[model samples]
Target: MNLETTSSWFLMAAFVLYCAAFIGFVLAVTGRRWADRSPEQHQRKWGWVSFGISAAGFGAHLAFFFTRWAAAGRIPTSNMFEFMTFLAMMTTAAFLIIYALYRSPVLGAFAMPVGFVLLAYAAVFPQEISPLIPALQSHWLMIHVTTAAAGEAFFAVGFAAGLMYLLRVVNFKPTTSGGRAQVFFVELTIFTVLAIVGFVGTVFTFKGAGYEAVFLQEKSSVDQKGQLTTTEETVTYTMPPIVKPYNSEMVRMTPFLGMKEPLFETPSWMNGVNAGRKLNTVVWSLLTAAIMYAALRLILRKPIGAAIQPALDGMDPEDLDEISYRAIAIGFPVFSLGGLVFAMIWAHKAWGRFWGWDPKETWAFITWLFYTIYLHLRLSRGWLGRRSAWMAVIGFVVVMFTLVGVNLVIAGLHSYAGV
Candidate 1:
């Protein structure tokens, strides 16, 4: 088999191993009180077993990365599919390092799913190894992207630990107003994650069903020579169109559940083909998330947060809080080097400017500043425990928005990364 095909098999193997390891970690944390074995021994034995499996998975993931790099004749971090896989791998690597220091089964249980979801999310995009555009053909592609992803992986680890900390400590019933607000925010965070997972499932479901919608749009662009060029482009959607491309004509659409056409045209302000598709995707994702959340609520007959709180019963809130803080602390400098410093240098090299206030650049700086505040507040302003954990959680949201949302909502020089 070709290296490209071999690399895909390796990635599939890594994903399967990660899933199995997540189950093992969950058992390690949640099944410790079982009568079959001593709690300490069960925890210790399964923790090692899970860690070993996760490490093997990481090795397989590394093989996938290297083989893909060799097949593509460039670093694989040049596009969405490649970057997400790398990010997932780095997240697992970060979890392994953190687990070695603390031997925390709960961390593995939480962190492993983050990698799993990311790897799955990567699959949503096309996996073909296309040649990089001129803008991305630089040594800096590997240096800047990989380091930034490694650092963000730690932040993702921190988010997992912080989420566990909240699950351990937050009151489920929440009689008081403040307690109710805390419960709301925590549940909101969980729902957001569900939405992303739902988004992936929704995409694949329609894709597998061979759903198709086509729109023809006219695009106007100004060339470097200051001439206006008009072109007709065909945009296709795998999902049923809730909104068609702005100012575009429908070429064809297969009926879905008796819906023969789009509900409306996307607003003129949201003119790009990608923007319309993205907005429609957001609508479908939220709907799917609601259905999934309702199903879970009905099955459990309780709030999701309350159901998860039981697994975290014996875990210490303070330890989780500390782990979250330390993970971010370690990632901060690495992010500084990759997300800010090296990024600026590469931007200068590529665009002949260090900073252009592009959407991605602005968001990257904002992410750095947000983390900077997290560190400062924890160190100088006595924001530890619950407060610190909340910051870690919110910081992760900022990081994700920087990574994903900017591309979805805005167009700029970094638009290529979104594709």
Candidate 2:
């Protein structure tokens, strides 16, 4: 087979291996009660086994990366699919490093699912390797994107560790208002993860079923000579349309669940060809997440957080807190180098300015500042345990918004990366 096809197979293999590693990790954490095996021995044996599988998966992932780069004649991070997969790979690398130091199977239980979600999210985007645009042809593209994604991957690991810390420490059965508030936020965090899973599941389900909708959007713009130009752009949707693009006519729509057409038009202020489609995807994700959550509630007959608390009974909360802090500490300087320093250098070469305050640039700055505050508060202000964990969780949210939300919700020079 060609290198491109081989790369695809390797990526698929890496994904399968990662899934298997997650199962192994889960077994390591939860299989202590198995007959005839000492709990410590069982966990130790399975932890090493799971870590081996994870390391092998990371090897496969690297093979896919380099092979695809060779086949494409460029780094494979030019678009959403390549970038997201790279992020997933980097997250695995970070997890492996942290796991080596800590030898904690619980970390694997949390971190592998994160890698799973990122890889699945990458699959939602187009996978074709296209030539770089003029603006993206510089070596800085490799330096800047890869390094920044690497930094973010460490932050992802920090988030996973932080989340595990919270799950271990939070009081599920609350007596006071503060305890209840903590429960709410923790559950909300879990719900957000489920929402992302719902999104990936929903996209793939409809895509595999061949569901489609199409629209013709009329866009009005002013030319340099002050002439008004109206253009028609075709917007396609792979999921049934809950809403159509603003000021657009439907070309065709496949019926879904007794809905023949979009239920409403996108708001005129949304202001992008695919804005309506993105909004619809968000709606569907939330809907699916709710359904899944409700089903889980029925099956477990308790709040998801309460149900999960038992699995973490023997974990050391302090160790989890330390791992979360250490991961973020390592990621902080890396992020500063790549997201700020290298980005500024690339901006100067490409756009003749280092600080344009573009949406992506602005958000990247915000994310860096947020992490800076996190480190400062933890070190100088005595924020530890619950407080530090919350900061780690919130920090990843900022990183993700900078990476994904800024592209989808706002337009700027880096919008090309969104595709």
Best-fitting candidate, measured by TM-score?
2
Against the unseen true structure, what C-alpha lDDT does each candidate score? 0.91, 0.91
Estimate the TM-score for candidate 2: 0.98
- TM-score per candidate, in order? 0.97, 0.98
lDDT of 2 at 36: 63
Tens digits of per-residue lDDT, candidate 2, 1-419, equal 99999999999999999999999999998998773688888999999999999999999999999999999999999898999999999999999999999999989999999997899999999898899988788999999988899899999999999999999999988899999999999989989999999999999999999989999999898999999999998999999888788889999999998999998887777653267788788788999999998999899998898887777888899999999999999988998999999999999999999899998899999999999999999899999999999999999999888877776577688888776
lDDT of 1: 0.91
How displaced is residue 373 in candidate 1, in Å?
Answer: 0.3
